[model samples]
Target: MDRSLDQLRRRLLIHCTPSQAHTAAEIATAHDTGLVVTGASADTIAHRLREKGFDGPILCDADRYSGPRRVDGGRGIRPAWCRRQQELGLVPLTDSGYLEPDNWNALRSILRVAALQRRPVIAMLPLAARWFAESHAVDDLARELDSYGVAVAVAIEHASDPFSVQYVVRHFLRLLRTAQVPVLLLRSDVAALGALCHGAFAAATGTTSSLRHIYPLTSKGIPRAAFPAVFIRHLLSYHRLDTCETVFARTPETSHFWLCDCVVCGGTTPDRLHDSDDQYSVALRHSLHAQLLLHDEIFRHTDTPDQRASAWHEACSHALFVHRQVAEHVPDWRTPAHLKSWHTVTDDPLRGRAGIPAQPTQRSVLFERPAEKWSAHERRGV
Candidate 1:
């Protein structure tokens, strides 16, 4: 997949969990999207890429050396694992530390370990924004990342709130301009998505390639929504921001929304992860459709530049029309009693462990800076 970058116009990144490499490889083949191998034991997962016919680059995780999930409390993001990925020739990516300032130091230590093993594609794990944009410290850190001579990608969030969609898009584009670090923006609102695309489409006349979208998508879970999320990629194409459908491959979870009767849907009646008739199925469909369609509406309904200047106007109309159809066809469902009770019972075991505490306030930070930064450094590069 040397030409993989040319194929994926939108640059899809699929989240692979529960099942890792093999499943990701399967998605790569089906959706023809890029692979981002998340979860622990990423080196092991990466080995499955070629066998599954995935030609695009793989995004290996920082899980093995010393995250909370490490077995035997093994040092997370192991040097050996990173070495293994280098040996296999996979592209690498590390999360930007979040929830606090010092998290960068902690993540930087992990990156140093990988550097010792000669890993490529080193990225900075910046803090995730709750209500504001990336701070000066964050920008300074990105500049430091640039100094390291490696590619940098920063993480940001788009939550389920009223301003979530526009806030992410606007601020993210702004960040890309200020920091020079590649930005990954998450979209969640269909109309806001259309509005964003329309805005970008208008701005695109003077923009360069660096200003285009670099969407790395994942699901809350495989959605059995009204339409397959692939439709979202199509909208991205209209502005040329989401381009290159010829090179990269995406993870299989990309086919999630088109449940049942589809090959990837796992056909067995009882095996259906969310059988259409299951009580959770209706809500499942909504949850799945809600976010993915935001992307889909942009691609499917957003008009091409040649069609008319009222592209966004038409896209909004189409999104509303499709939304109405989804409401009519998909059943009204609620969160299941068992799952809700589990949440109430566990009362959040994950909180303290991941450095998140009960009643977490902004004061409780998830990461602390590393005491040291260098094993010794010359320079690094992509």
Candidate 2:
């Protein structure tokens, strides 16, 4: 790998929409962070970033997997767009078809195109959940991808259920173990951190929920909320601004868990997150910084793969404990199902072998809420 790609390892690639590009550039200028933008905004965003003095690596998502017809939408892959990507200093992604259980032809065609290009090109493979449930398909795909010697970007369709995502993650790790090529997990949320822990070359999460995952476009447009969700690191999930305020208001003493000390937050607590014309920008910067802090913690643990996995598992377990403790006080703040699913998978003994795991655990923890029992400094340590 070259110096630019090398810098991407163990780092969170912030996926920015056209509107968020300026903020991301400001943040990227200070940190060794890579920015991902769609092909539509690639040239403009890259130009703006360069003008703003950010010369780091920029990735352009071809975004060809959403529709069936290649030329149906302007966002789909085209020769002109690919050339534009090259001009903007990006490793062009092929206009690969979305991969389903029976879509071996599409996968093979992408690899063949990568070989013909004779340059470093990322083969973006948008997968369906069925790819994970079918082990034979995953093995075949991984073998073919490894032989091509081209970097791969894997994007899964939106899945509301954790089981659906778990399948994708398990198969993703299998590919990482088998393939020598770099693999990137795109359009993710908290799952991005889990991917980095288990050896993903890079992972991306959007500033808003809609961009966080790949959703099939419907005739009926999905409505986006006025204010984006706030990322609470302690809970390992995103919550609405109103939800955060409610949690803090109900259990004022326990607000320490959600308070952020990142550069964006300074000394301000999450309880003060309210809707304003500028609240979205504040949430976006805070979310990005909070994720960076957690990513740093994971990367700082210089140990073997098993040890890293153990550390991540411990963090998830502690987050779950915090969730339960908060629920004990705030009735409406129940733990999200995906959080429980993440902890369960990390706790499996087989997690060491595959780097990711399946199977669920029924274990439960009973602990007294620590707000009253611990000092402010001690509580911060938790």
Candidate 3:
């Protein structure tokens, strides 16, 4: 096992489909990361990338979404299909369909096939499986997967609440620490920041609203109306209103207060996000830029575990400060309800320890100094 894979710092992977291949290629040219191509059109995407001369590392996923039933009835395309994808110089991943506690047999079969074919697999462990499993069970499962040497990708099937999301991520990180393998948090969105802070290898989100938002397990993709929205870099949250007019009407002062420094929206007002003819592309570009910035910021202080914990603690403090700012400045601006819970749970002194006590109001000042200036006071027992 590569020791670097186990020591997660900050890595971002953009998730896309064949329809967004051109956009993905564009982003890949700018960012220093790979892309995870999902959906039933994996083959098409592979071919498109080849024709477009995209030579970046590409990890192909078989499952599009989690659901009650497997996307393809627990049986992905035939071995021939996998062979064809590999022939195109794309890494073929096993279709570890919607992982659940009761479906270990199905997951085992997927891993077995991947091992037989001598391919490194990407396993999707559902949120429920992590939440319901005991610590020993999680540890044992991680140990069992070490033999296959596959990269684990977590699918948060149900994280509607902030506290639950933080707890689940903490649990998953603990489990992955034992696995000693590369891990990816899939469809993590803003929560990807938390995953990076907790030492996951990589985190991914989509280009559009439907792709960014986590929904219940479904065989079919849900169609959602897209609106122009700005991703607040400091708070690590998205602010979406009914329309551009509404966003402008509500956030003129707030926009001036918290300007985005990302290249995509630098020096421009937040309301200008909707001014682009291609709003989705603009939003995606902003998001990708913001993610890379956050990753770099976290990576700067990751020399040791203590240093990393201090940096993460500072980040949590900054997130809390921004959360409070959003509440005060943009009362009409809606943020994820789970954002507060995530802040609360991560700030707990006894987090990841047994018998977690009642959440307390975090009093740590926001991180404003340079990364090198962080000291013992910021470590927070992490």
Model 1, TM vs. native: 0.46
lDDT of 3 by residue, 1-382 (tens): 4433322225577777667766676666555556777766777786778788776666666654453444532453246556766787655555555554546565566555655663544555544434434667767667767777777676656534322455564567576568776767766576666666666677776665545544565555554555656565555666652443454455444444345445555544444666566666666666666666666555653555444444555555565665565556545655555555455545433334232111123322222222232223212111
Q: Against the true structure, what is each candidate's TM-score?
A: 0.46, 0.83, 0.76
lDDT of each: 0.34, 0.66, 0.56
Q: Where does model 1 exceed 4 Å of error?
A: 1-9, 18-24, 63-78, 95-99, 102-104, 107-119, 124-126, 130-142, 156-167, 181-382
Q: Write the candidate numbers in order of decreasing TM-score.
A: 2, 3, 1
Q: Score residue 223 of candidate 3 by CA lDDT.
A: 48
Question: Higher-lDDT candidate among 2 and 3?
Answer: 2
User: What shift in Å separates residue 176 of candidate 1 from its native position after superposition?
Assistant: 2.3
Instruction: Summing lDDT over every window of 10 consecutive residues in candidate 2, give the lowest-scoring window.
Output: 362-371
lDDT of 3: 0.56
- Candidate 2, residues 94-213, lDDT tens digits: the string is 666566655666677767666666356677777666776656777887788888888888877654532235656566667767778899887678888777777788888777666676
User: Could you tell me the TM-score of candidate 2?
Assistant: 0.83
What CA root-mean-square deviation does each model show from the true structure?
18.8, 7.6, 8.8
Select the stronger candidate by TM-score from 1 and 3. 3
Candidate that beats the other on lDDT, 1 or 3, i.e. the better one: 3
Per-residue alpha-carbon lDDT of model 1 for 73-131, expressed as tens digits? 11224455445666777655543233233455565564455445453444434334432
